[model samples]
Target chain A: MVFKGAEMVIESLRKEKVDTIFAYPGGAVIPIFDVLFDADDINVVLTRHEQAAVHAADAYARTTGKTGVCIVTSGPGATNTVTGLATANFDSVPLVCISGQVPRNMIGNDAFQEADTVGITRPVTKHNYIVTKRENLGKTLREAFHIASTGRPGPVVVDIPKDILYQPLEETYPEDVNLQGYTSPGKGHAGQLKRAVTAVNDAKKPLFFAGGGINVGDSSKIFRNIIEKTGIPVVTSLMGIGALETKNPLNLGMIGMHGTYAANLAVSECDLLFGIGVRFDDRVTMNLEKFAPLAKIIHLDIDPSAIARNVPVEIPIVGDAKIVLEELYPLLDKKDRPAWHKTIKEWKDEAICINAYEGFNAKEDDSSYLMPYQVISTVNRTFPDAIVTTEVGQNQMWTALFWNFKEPRTLITSGGLGTMGYGFPAAIGAAIACKDRRVVAIAGDGSFQMNLQELATAVKCRLPIVIVILNNGYLGMVRQWQQMFNGGRYSSTHLNDRIKADKEDKVSPDGSPDFVKLADAYGAEGCRVRSKSELEDALKKAAALTDVPIIIDCLIEPEANVWPMVSPGAGLDEMVFCIEKEEE
Target chain B: MNHVISLLVENNAGVLARISGLLSGRGYNVESFSSGPTLDPDITRITLVCRGDDTIIDQIKKQLNRLIEVIKVSDLTNKHTIDRQFALLKLLVQPGNRGEIIQLAEVFAAKVMDVGSDTMILELTGSEKKIEDLVQLLDGNIVEIARSGLVSIERGRKHAAVSQK
Candidate 1:
């Protein structure tokens, strides 16, 4: 049957089993939107901004382990998805973003709403295509999904011109299109896996340094099983939070700057650091020279380049983490490393805050203020089974630290890109992807404001996402950095109008909008709390609401810093647990 | 050290831009890059000469391989290979030095493509060292030169694009 290009797009989506898409409309996409209007099979979420649409899709993909889809119009609408695309790209989230372009003939003519979507998104996407021919639409769209959701998955852009959608063509979708160059390696080289297994067996103090790939590759079960079988302790990157249950004795919390004391110390002291599906990022490896200096590294990753790109490895096994781990598991010789476990436990005990410790309240001259950690911990306690999303900076770090993520894909955050304004919209996505589970977003005052407009979308969808805003009244993470390193010069990092007004000694605090009122304006429930009791009460109330989203604004201490910081250039071993007060 | 990487890629639009962009975007230093349609119209062979240490070169190769368009990336640096660069030189042909320039070009096996009243354009294809030596010999008399970077091939039957075949 002859099909309009727009109809073919929908046909491809159905073939891919896509039931929903987050999109924002504009002049270039009117035809596609018109087709979508009657496309009852697909649930279309209209986000206020294009960026939120992509972020929502990204989180949806992360939680559901499916290729998330988003469609936006040309020019500014397409450009707005850049940040979200980069976020997904960095995190290796599978996403197919269909951007409407100007007419094929006017693509380069600077026509109205014209932008080089393919050119602009080239470096940030896994692969991109500009569908010029009507017949190529089916193949291109299907190939876009294939390229996006396969090996080392990432965002792919398919920029289809407006005029192409109007053309009719016979619908013939290829079940699969094989590209000559691309091959997603499944099983690792047997020899390398044997060597890796040998290294693990031989080492006295071996530690599994898992990254987001464990979750992304769906290898968490195998990873945990290997850990269980071998009795080896594990440390995770921020993205690797849920790969192993944080409560497991072998699972030392996150490792790196701001990592649990045990996890960092164990990494520093371990003999074998088996990095599975992880790129040893600079943040994770504070001082590369000193990072795991004593460890013999065995790096296993799906991406061949990732193996030896960051740190030298003794055995580099290139394959999917799940397949490689499965192959290696049979070769592993179980061992009970009591001495290593003893050492790790001792290190864990040495940490200032024990595992599962609630956040400490801020103390200043007998006045107590709510801490960011307390708010996050309170949410963690209230919604123990909820899928938690976090904004960047102190809030993200705090959540990563305190939240007990027992399973993979439970804690969704922009770990790689560290994009602010990510959590609330991501929560909206998580709520949609898993309708049975509650979704909570822990964000900072500044980050919540960045995309608070998404509240309207959440309210409209009747998504019961409890947003816990740690209202510290400042850009807390940057402020912490400025305070520690910039001689207490709190500059542009301050987000509170009251503080800024005091500093300027002129402007009124009236400019700072009340978040509760803002939430009310968006047709969602809103409440503010200052004390611990009030915070719990608000959380309980918000959790009870089945269809309405509620914003809980907790007035946290402005000066709370994420402690145990491995100061930028310092070694992970040289973690400063707490800063000594300087003479004023 | 400098490395010569031979790549066979799908002859698709934006493949070249993707390769060059990967280099510039990742801060890898590309000394020279040249590409053209290969024997198969659907394939393109790109010769890239880049400067990097072993780690950087390894990363450059792996990154290039990571691109979907790139079918094969063979580092011809350590291999026994035939490497040549083509250059077109426009040299000033003053009466006093015209014979000397022609003689130098002859020694280098360069072809005289055109001769103006005061200038001559010579087309030369040789190893980088040979071209450099000739340029040095004809130093001041040369007005301008355009050089195609280095294109290399393996010495024997082992083919880089064998996988495609």
Candidate 2:
């Protein structure tokens, strides 16, 4: 059947099995919104900010493995999508951002609310298009979805000028699309498979460094098989968490800065490194020159540019992780390496000991604010396999360091873009996708405000997500930078007085809404915790609830900062550890 | 080892980025790449040259096939392919040697696209090896060469026809 562009978009999404969409309305995108209004099949959430809409969509994409779609208006509306687009792109989350542009005639004339959205989002998106004609909308939408979900999945944008969205066109969605310039590597190269096998056989201390690509490619089975057969110890990047069970004997835990001492130590001493579907981001390879210095690197990724982009590789394989691993599986020899496995096991034991935190002693009756680490560890213990999403800042680092993730896609956070306020919406989305699994959002007070409005969306959708807010009364990350670089001159970091004032009345007389009151207003449960016991009880109760989202406002110390953090513009090896002793 | 790969793909948004992301993500080094629309609006031709051992190239081919948009992938390095590259060289020519340089250009069938008092620009299109040989012949007199990445076609066959279902 022939359909309008807006109707076609909804229809296409329906075909893709999408049920909900998060979006904000605007002038240029009224047509699509109008269509959505009449449509009862797909639910469109009205977000407070355009950015939040896209972020929610990204969260949905990550959790569902289906392309998350967001619709926004022209100019400012489209520009607002940039942050979410960049976040999705960096994290390799599949998203389709449909933006409304000024009519084609007014595009370059600098008309009202006109912006070069295609140009602005070029670097941030996997691919983008400006639909000047209505006829191309169906093909473009179909193609956009395909591109977003394909190899090394990422965000794709389609900029539809207002006129095209409004245009009445007899358009038929192509059952199949053919593109000429794009070729995704599907199978493992036979030669590379042979060489990888040879390298594995020849190596004495071979290690597998895994990354997020493994999850995106659904290579967990293949990865487990390869490791099981080859007896290669595996360490994951922060994004790579959950690829293998952390409890697995062969799993060495996450490696890099803030990584387990065992993982870093093992990588440093290995003779051969087989990196799969993971970029050697600076976070993983602290010192490029010294990283795996003793190892002969065998890099396998679908992207060719990643080969030798950071750490030089002796052999590079450009292919999908799932396919490549499958091909290499049978080629491998089943040789037992008990000595090497034992060595890794010993290192893991030491790591567990080093990372252990001693509980608060009764003798030391210090009534200081709750430690971030204690809060994170307690939550991890309570929800051992829960999908944990984090807002960027000290809380994100705390979650990464404390939560031992044992499944891929279980720890969904904006790693590459480091976007704040991503936790609540992402958690909500994850809760929706994995209905059987519990999802928790660990966010700092400052970061939480960025998308606090999403609490309403969660409540509306009846998504049972537990939000643990590390309310440090300041923008923790920026405040820490100010403390370190700005001579301890706290400019705008103070939030304690304001937080208390807002709590008293729950909303300002000037109509500014308090978060706790807002959560209650939206029919969701809310609690404020001051002690460790209170926080733990709130989390346990929240986890038990499956009808509505819960918000726990945690009163934490503003001075607390994530330790072992590598300061920007500083050497990777140089890290600022948390202070254990008072300054002299 | 260097390998030449010819891929037929659907001309769609993000296809190029997907290809580039896949290559770069895997740690494979792309030596050169060129892509353009074919005679059909739905199809496009992409020729990429990458450096790695045989196993790596094989992996690249396998991965390229997995991409939904990709119709076919052939490792042209060992195959009979009509490989061509375009290079435009601007040269600093003295009045005395201008005739000699023109004679050399005629021998190679290179066209003089631009001429100036002290500079002459020659446009040449040929196989990579042929272009390299031509560059060596005029090495001392050449000022600079701007190359468009290599583009190739399978010899005596079209990729679309073979892959069409």
Candidate 3:
């Protein structure tokens, strides 16, 4: 049977078993939108903008293990997705982004709203295709999904011109894909696995350094078992949160720039560093020379290029983390290192006094203003089973440090790109994927505006996401950096520009659009709190919502900073504790 | 150190941009680049001459190999290989200097492609060194020069076939 190009896409999506799509429509995609209007089986959540659409899809795929799908129209709609695609690319999240284009004849003529969608997105996507003819649409889509979901998954773009979408096609979606140059090995070598086992047996101080790849490989349960059986202490990169339970005695908190004292020190002193599905990013290994200097590193990753990109390794195994851990488990010897455990405990104890989270005593602090740590940890302590997402900045670090993520895929943040406006829309996507659990978007005032418009979509879908904006009147992170590293010249870091330097109070005026009123305009619940007690009251009210999202704006201390910060290029050990340490 | 890395990539649009963009982003100096279709319609072979030490070159290879389009990457720096380049020179053909230019072209095995009343275009296909010598021999008389970057092939049976892995 013959079908239009738009119908072909719908049919292909059905074959791929995609139940939900985050989309934004435009002139070039009117036909597709028309079809979608009547297709009750396919749930399309039209977001506020194209960026949110892609981010929502990205988060959906990251948490659900299915390929996330996004559809955007031509020109600006297509360009807005670049940041989301790059974010997905760096982390290897699977996304299939379909973009609308101008008519085939109008391409390259610079017609109205005609931008080169394929060219602009080429570098960001794993692969992209431009469909000039209708006959090849089925096969192209089949290949697009195959490439996106397999072999170290990543985002792919398919650009279809407006005219092509209306034309008739002869074939239905294909059942098979042709990818001659791609392969993903699932098994580790016997010889290499044995060498790793021997290194594990020979070392007195051994450590396990995990990353997001473990979660992507679906081996977290097996990972925890190996850690328990071997009795080795574990440290994870930011992406590796929930690698082991937060309360587990062996799971050292996140490692790197904002990593805990115990994790950094253990890595520095270990004789063996067993790396699983991790590429040592610069943030994780600030001074590459001093990182794991005394250790014989054993690295395992599915991507061959990631094996030896940064640090030297004695044994590099290229295979799936799930399969490799399953194989390595049988060969491992059960041994305990009590001396190493004692040393790590000391490091963990020292870290608590330095980390700012430990310094917060809600009732003891001055009652004039609210503390961010108090609010973040209060929510974490209250909602033990909820999923949390954070924007890039002080809010992200505070959540990562204080949330105590005890389960996998519970904490989502933009780690590689550190994009400011990631939290709100990503929370929407996660909420859609896991309807039974509450997904909270915790963002700072500076980062919240990046995609604040997404509030309307939350109300439309009744996502019931709890959004907490820690309004600190300044870009707190940059301000802290300027104070420490740049001679206290707080230039361009203030979000509240109305604050006069001569004013005695030196406090900026309230944020415009007043978040509470803004949320009210969208028909969603908005609550403002100025004290620690008010915040607690707001939390209780927000948690019981079933039909709408709650936006809670809390007035917070402007100068509060994330502590145990390693200076940009300094080694992991040289962390400068914040003001609480100075008071001592 | 200078190294010539050969890659077999899927013949698709934007594959070239992906490779060049990465090299540029990583600050690797691409001294020369050549790419063209292979006997297989679905694949293209790319040869890049980059300037870097061992660590930098290895980084370039690893990053390039990560691209889905790239099937195989072979470093031909130390391997036995054959390389050739071609250049087209548009030169001022004054009456007195015509014979001197002809003599230099004959020595370099350059073909005389186009000739007008006052201009001549000479095509030379040889090693890069030989092309450099001919250009130096006609330094003042040359008006325009378009040179194809270095293209190479392994000496014997060492081919960069698409590995199944």
Candidate 4:
């Protein structure tokens, strides 16, 4: 049987067991979709924009632990996917995006919808291919999947010209392609791993610093077990949340830029800082030179490039996280760490928020305002099992700082790329991937506007995603930065730029466009709330809805900020909490 | 100190960009770079020179090895190796001094590859010192010169080439 190039795409998708695909059909890709239109084995979701498709696929891959697939046409369709591709690339999410190109002959002629997909996406993708001939389609597509789902999985693009889709073909898909130079070390160097394990056993104040790799490597169970046996305190990078249960005795919350007070302090004072599957990004190591100064470091990462790229480590073990942890577990002589826990608990006591302490209210002074922290903590407690996604800025930092993420892959945020329009579409994708559980997206007004158009797609599919928008009327994170560093001149950060008609000196307190109206316009349920009492009732109502998507826009204090931030150039230990309450 | 890090990598498109990008991204200065295919057409042997202390060099090597297409990387900076550079010089040859130029080229074992009415082009291959001396001898008369960066092989069987065989 001769298969056309389009058939080969479906063949590869089937081979990889990709049941769900996020795609946008265009003129150049009609042929590929035509074949899929009648297929019963695949379920393809049509997103409003190519970018949303990619983000949806990204979240799907992250939550399901599968290689997510997306398809788009040439030119704008392919270009639009850049941000989503970048997000997947930075987080090491396995994704394969198939983009249709103009015919092979018309590629360089500036033909309609033509794009240099491979050239444009090179640096952002793990690997990419331009399929020039009909015969090369099968092998190229197969290799694209292999390369994407391999070690340190990442996004891969396969740009196939239109002419290649239809051909009279005799087939020969290779038994196996020879990818000679590609090999990831499965087992770490025995000597290096042994020395690392020895360091952990010898140190009294050992700290296990886990990162997103725990999820990527499928090693969270082993990591939790080992940490329990070892009695070492644990601190996580933002991406490393859910590496182990946050409630674990050993687990200290996330550490880094907006990390909890105890976590950063523990890292500063620990004797042995064992980092697993994490690149020491700036957010994680606030000031590299002063980070973990007292700790003798042992870094275990599958990506050798990440091992010592930032701060130097004494022992470097390059191997799969699961395999390395399995090997290292046997060598450790588990010991209790009482002194370390006592030190960490003292710091935790200082980190707790008095305002978010169950019943505290911001309504005492200003009856019109609600605190952002209260909304997030309320959502966390109401739907304790929900997978939370947050857009960039205050909403993301607030969720990272306050929410309790107990399991790996439960909290999906754009940690590395910090993409603004990510949370809602990603939440929809997560809902699709894990249909039994609830997926809630906590976003700021500024971020929600960037991808609010995706609300139409969510309602069309009845995704049942609950979106909670903290309508602070400003880009809260940037405004906080401007307030603290720029002499309190709130420049372009405020969302409410409209001047009031009656009051000459006052800016309009009304938040623009009314999020409830925007939600209603998109054909989904919308609720707007102001006082603290109304916040819980709205969230509960939104959470109870099962048939359609729900958007709960909470009117929050414009001056609300993510506290305990490590100023850009400062050390993690140098966090200046915004604790001196400003008079209302 | 300058370190020469050798890498055997897949001849995949974008592999070179990734390796070079990694160095530049990490703020490591690349002093010299030379790359070409090994005996196996599928693999290319890459040699890059970076200047740094021991800590930085170690990071550079580890970074290079982290690239998915990079098969192996080693620091050849301190290893005993045979190294050479190739250079081609085009010089203006006055009628009165043409013989002197030919004699100088002969002494250095440089081949005269082309001769125009007013100029002669000489191709020379040797250690950097020899090329430097030849250029010095042909000073003022030389119009333009192109030099290949340094390439090296370990003195014996300690390099990647012999081990691959």
DockQ of each: 0.85, 0.13, 0.55, 0.49
Better of 1 and 3 by TM-score: 1
Residue B53, model 4: lDDT of 85
Candidate 2 CAPRI assessment class = incorrect
Clashing pairs in 1: none
Q: Residue A121 deviation, candidate 2, in Å?
A: 1.6
Count of clashes, each model: 0, 38, 0, 0
Total clashes for model 2: 38
RMSD (Å) of each candidate, 1 decimal: 2.5, 6.6, 2.8, 3.1
> Where does candidate 3 clash, by residue pair?
none
Candidate with better lDDT, 3 vs 4? 3
| Candidate 2 segments exceeding 4 Å error | A168-171, A333-339, A356-366, A478-523, A563-577, A580-583, B1-165
Per-residue lDDT for A1-584 in model 2, tens only? Answer: 76776777777788767788888888988888888887888878777788888887887777667888888888899898899999998888889988889888888999998998877887688778888678888988888888888877888888988877766677677667656546567876678678878988888888898888888778887898888887788988877877887778888767776666667777888888899888898877877766877888889988775677667788889899988888888888778777787888887676555444333111123355677877887778888878889998778878876777776778888887888878877887777677898888999877887888787778877888888888777788778878877877778776555445534735334432355676798898988776778777888788789889888887666587765555554433354554445578
- lDDT per residue for candidate 4 within A12-87, as digits (tens), equals 7887788999999988888899889977899998899899999999999999889999999999999999999999
lDDT of 3: 0.86
Binned by DockQ into CAPRI classes (incorrect, acceptable, medium, high), candidate 3 is medium
Real contacts recovered, all predictions: 0.75, 0.18, 0.50, 0.46
Taking all chains together, the TM-score of candidate 3 against the true structure is 0.95
Clashing pairs in 4: none
The lDDT values for all models are 0.88, 0.79, 0.86, 0.84
TM-score of chain B of 4: 0.91
